[model samples]
Target: MTGRQVIVRRARAEDIPGLVASSAGLFAEDGGTRDSSVNVDWPREHGARSFAAALDDPARLVLAVEHDGQVVGHLMGSLTGPTAKRPVTSATLVSIHVRPGHRRARAGDRLVEEFLDWARRQGAEHAEVTAYSANTDAVRFYERSGFAAMTVTLRQPL
Candidate 1:
């Protein structure tokens, strides 16, 4: 904890750098460690364009968590509209990460709450997120945030 108030808000154009940094950190610390094929450098190389496009899309939400005036965390979410076969609006919590020092400080809770609020506003009846099955901490966090395990995804190496 930096002893400074943490603020979570929608990301703006100027926060792209911070968003990219946080995303890269997530890939390095989480994906790189848990998955064999994660490209840790992708965020540094292509995040700016992706995040910029996300910022401009109404169906997406990008949030930044700042502590001591520095971006230490971020969350990205998207809404999917009703389809011909599945006529339900759904929201997906695409990704979220907070610096180690910023964890246990309610920053993640704030991000999830804001995203849920936005989804509700958009008439989303359900929300979902996918976490690595081995990451128990994240599974617990999402469970505490009102998410339940709805299905399992398994993979076998070739």
Candidate 2:
């Protein structure tokens, strides 16, 4: 789709539903699965409430990209603690997702651009984001947006 247009802007409480749906898509695409119906209902309610709260947080940034009047993507970035060990003001990209049909339209780039601008204005000196080690698409997106491999994390089922 050439010559397509997308708008990226601050998310409002009304966008919470779409935001949660996009988040579910991100989780699923990242290899997450639902074990029961409660899984969906729980996150749907909890995620919506969280996103709605973040929308009002001055220290956080939540932005959405819309196409043809429908929200197609969302990005959430947050300011992290600056302790002596990590003294610099850091902004961690909590999550970002673009609907399947919305990929390649630069919506993700626009979201990152807006988030970075906000993070900088809020005194963040460093930015970080984590991706599933095997989800190269997300890793590539972050790399293209100027992120480099900074740390390695390992996990195991307990």
The lDDT leader among the candidates is 1
lDDT tens readout by residue for model 2, 1-158: 33167788898888888888888777666646422222545446588888988988887898988888877889999998678898888998998988878777888888898889988998999899988777878888899999999889876656
Off by over 4 Å in 1: 2-4
lDDT (0 to 1) per candidate: 0.93, 0.82
- Tens-place lDDT digits, model 1, residues 6-102: 8999999999999999999899888989998888899999999999999999999999998877888999999997999779999999989998888
Which 10-residue window in model 1 sums to the lowest lDDT?
1-10
Q: Clash number for every model?
A: 0, 0
TM per candidate comes to 0.96, 0.88
Q: For candidate 2, give the lDDT.
A: 0.82
